[model samples]
Target: MQLADLRRYGASHTIIQSLRDIGIKDIYPPQLEALRLGLLSTKDSFVIASPTASGKTLIAEMAILKTIFEEVGKVIYLVPLRALAGEKYADFSRKYKPLGIKVGVATGDYDSRDPYLAAYNVIISTNEKMDSLLRHSSPWIHDITLVVADEIHLITDAHRGPTLEVVLARLRQTNPNIRVVALSATIRNVHDIARWLNARVLESTWRPVPLKEGIYFDKSILFDDGSHKEVEVATIYDPINIALSVLDEGGQALIFVNTRKSTESVAAQAAKEVGKRISDGERKVLEQASEEVLKALAEPTRICRRLGELVKYGVAFHHAGIHSRQRKIVEDFFRENRIKLLVATTTLAMGLNLPSRRVIIRDWWRYQPGYGMGPIPVMEIKQMGGRAGRPGYDDHGEAVLIAKSRRDQAFLFEKYVGGEPEQVISKLGTESALRSHILACVATFLAKSEGEILDFISYTFFAIHKDPTDILSIVREVLRFLIEEGMIKEEGGNLKATPFGTRVAQLYIDPLSAVIIRDALFKAEERDRDLTPFSFFHAISATPDMMVLRLRKRDYEKLTPHIVARKDEFLLPLPGEEDQEFLAQVKTALVFLEWIEETPEDKIVGGYHIGPGDMRALVELGEWLLYSSYEIGRVFKLRRAVKYLSPVRKRLAYGVKEELLELVALQGIGRVRGRNLFNAGYRTIRDLKKADIEALTKVPTIGKEMAKDIKRQVT
Candidate 1:
């Protein structure tokens, strides 16, 4: 079917014209099959099971534009990650704004008081942000007409699955007639998901660029289709060798490694190989990308320097360790074909619109802290493979797994190449996920009674797949715990969220996080002792949201003594039940305390064995939890801790000590500027207000324009 034919399925002329303008005159075969299956035409929901880059997004675009054109209502396009949300918002806004569509993105900040998205025709958000909005009972959600769940298969994800499942269930309950659209990659038992959403199933294995799967051994790749190709190999791991071969063929390659360290190592190695082959023009392009990398980092962090050095050879690495903007720059460079190779971690597997002619799986086994090393899931392997074959650029793509031995080669082929992707499983009934959602439901008055709460939960994917008895039992247990913790209370035989419960939900923090904060505050206030930042850091690190750093044996031995020495300074006694987990939390808190003390990032990484990604993650989660802890402290009347925590939270956020908190609040200011101003006799807003623009500009890290901006802010 032609793209113009979508008009018959209720796509407006503007939509069709937009499609044509982008050279999408003909609909891809898989999307055509879905259209024939009444994906956009029908009022019912749809679960589109297809490969990545197979026009799933276009199908969703058609639906979103069609629904908005009909004046049906506002549309919600849900993506799994903030990056995907930003990408979708940009794409939709760019293409459809001219066609009279108003698109808005909501992520990171969930200010319930501001329904800024109400004016938008289409709203793009992450699953968690959407869930938070729903919990806040945002007035705009009820107006939602079309709901698109991109990466619907994430329902199998244990950490994220419950929120998606419960959010969908709530939307279904609130707006029963709302149209749902789920776009997914190939997964086993697609019909089960279809059954959960009450949507028609459109299954297509067709790829816009046909993929060739193979196993690489001893410089030769044995294709699954019984074809063979000899490739050069001079390194121990031949991902770089395979990538060099792909570059020789005039196509880009994506090398998937298991760790960030491997990504940098492989990119550096690949750059060395490709450097010799780079042309002058290509060298110029690489230089531009390198400049952008440095510009993204003011002081050129270690990761930035490494990335900039590698990109000079038309090769780069991407992982969470790199800043988001820097990563986006790398992606843009790769998209323009200036970069020949992108070495990445499992982060690439999650819905990024990056495609290449060749994908090399450098590691098939992943190391988990508790489980040692385990083979990668078949679905993960498939997701990485799906990155191959840019539709317009490559006629065909290749996905190959590397093996060192024949026995290992056979196992790789049997387990990943020949294996079927796993089916989605519901995790809605997990104790913590269940508790958080249940509190949200009660706090927002979505479910007033136990029966109503049960009914609400009954609509989840967990209830659809399993017996109700188990879920009901878990819900009751969670309710009892919440009541015991003073988050909720039972009155007149109906469960009601207390003021504390409502605050917890409004803060978008886990109920268990509040519990830990309350316990820590109570213990601290119970006695009259000094409360240190390390004490509170330890408290927040043990919360569900904070990622605990792993403590090596030598590190643990070093920290164990410090922790023991500082035992009196901690608010609550450390948990004695789980020694290892407690020690890890202590290690995490120590690192955080060091961070707030203005420790150098590279020094922290070297001493604590934490990555840039982990530091970024730690700061973000720690700041939020600190705010939550402060609010909870205020609620419980821990006056001393509350006063101490307020300034400390600001310090944690701006990466400054308490003295710079007053200056960091100004516009065009951050840690570096905040410190500079403080060191330059501008310790507070009053000092800044009294200073002249010349004095401000004389301060280190502050220029004329920035000084004027600071003056304006202070005055």
Candidate 2:
């Protein structure tokens, strides 16, 4: 299966040369099988279940390029995460743009139809973003001839699976002839998914780099192949000792921990030993990388400082807590082999190209809210372990699980070493999951009546894996709720979304969240009560879509008084004292209040017991919800609430006080730069407009280039 062989299936000469330029000379077995199954030549769909790095992406690439060369319609590459979307976008753009292929990425603003994406030959998008585009009925969607669903196994994910399921069903429903290339990391139920999609299945356990499974106990490893090895490392810390042994063998280690704190603590602990192995040249590079991490934030938080220091020693920890830019730096450094040891949470296992020679599962058990401590799913453990080998670098990869005792070692060997991954099941059985989707069906004309809605759902993976009767009840309940809440209407055996329902669907919010917002605003108007900023923030925070801050035990006492003082100011009525959700809403709303009040990022993260990235996520979510609330208010004709929400949405996005909003609106300006200009007597855009470049350069943090750019924007 050479790159040249793809030409038999319509791969262009430029595509072959591009593959060779990137050193992709031969296709792996699974990819070869896909191609043989008419992946490129035919219009059939495929469900490819193979291990990570097994060339699943290349198969999709061949099909995508074939479509483009044949003058087929547009292509949509769907990913489960924004980071993966960005990765695919960059890779495709860099490789194919010179060949006259236009690549675009859409992972922002769920409410947008992204009409601009119509101009691209290929559009990479996260599943949720694609679903939003479908709800808005983006005209370009009709032009799509193929959809490459990366990480298609996420259809079993409880939180995000429903969206992917609905998106796939809807795409197929709208485009009856659309080709699908669904990729997954070797799930047990590949056949079930294949049956649902009516696609051919290609399953394989082959890896470009061979993987070895083992269990570690008492400085010794028992390989699943019935072999034993003794380690000479002199450290009681199991992760550190394991990492050191791998470093001695001239390979890097990726240690997976159960918690964010463990990632940092373990990386810091391993940094001491890892530092001794670094050469002076490597040390200089690591130092530069560390500085880049620090500069990712305007005012580095404590976590950022810790990560920066560890990166200097060729060690780094990664999790959702780190800012996106810093995470990119760490990923790039590790991929370049500048970082010797990388510690990360389960997020690293999802779908990223960062691979290492050794994968250490430091924590196999995680805390489940109601279930106490439970073992991680074998599927997820395998996904994490599959990242062990870097193809073309390491000949073999070791996935080691640490055990403290003989019993634990035996358990690990039997459970994970020889275990089969669980079957993929549909997670579209809950009301919260079906509400927005049902509304979207009606709003987008995918379904017009209850029977048609069920018909649309029959295409979902849920219909195949579970009893349709179960989802039938949930769907009916959701429909009733939508109608009673005035989001939809039933007239003469037909179903349709009202203007409010259409707006809610297009806004990409749960219909219940819209109901809550609309009712709160209406109540406030009827009572003729004026509300504060906290009231608006709290209203959005209580919605199901908002990921509210965790309520610590101490926060209950601390937030009670503030809640009491502002109780009357809230648009929604206060919850009872025993409601933890009430406390969370108040606490989360305060974070937003501080954000818009011009508080430093570090201070806000510290006070809220969250990471800087977490704070940023809250702000981003808050901004979207506020904007949605404003749009919903307009649909309901809540004029007063609409006026207050428009300015507040802008303030939340920039994380600045109301007075500094004008300054932050400029291209190069942010919360900090906006404040610098405001405090320097440039209070508004008008003030900056009247100033010259030289005068603007006098302000703190404003360099000559930036000053000139600012002046250019104003002029």
**Candidate that scores best on lDDT:** 2
TM-scores vs. true structure, each candidate: 0.96, 0.97
Best by TM-score: 2
lDDT of 2 by residue, 133-159 (tens): 998888999999999998888898888
Worst 10 residues of 2 by lDDT: 523-532
List candidate 2 stretches off by more than 4 Å.
6-23, 369-372, 526-530
Give the range where candidate 1 is weakest over 10 consecutive residues by summed lDDT. Answer: 569-578
Cα error of candidate 1 at position 471, Å:
2.8
State the C-alpha lDDT per candidate: 0.84, 0.87
Clashes of each: 0, 0
1-715, model 1: which lDDT tens digit per residue?
A: 7666676666667767767764577788877777777765677799998987888888887777668776568999988898899998888888777767788998885436348889999999899999889878889888998999999998988888888888899999989998889998899989988888899998888998999999999889998899999998756558888888888888999999999888988888777778877889989989988999987754457888888998999889888768787889889999999888998897457955789999999888898756788888888889899889988899999999999999988988888888899978897777888888999999988887778888887788887778657767788898889999998898898789988898898888889888988898887676666678888888898888788887787875787687778887776665663488888888888888887888877777778865566678789889989998988888888898898888888888877787777777887687777777777788988888899998888888789999999888877
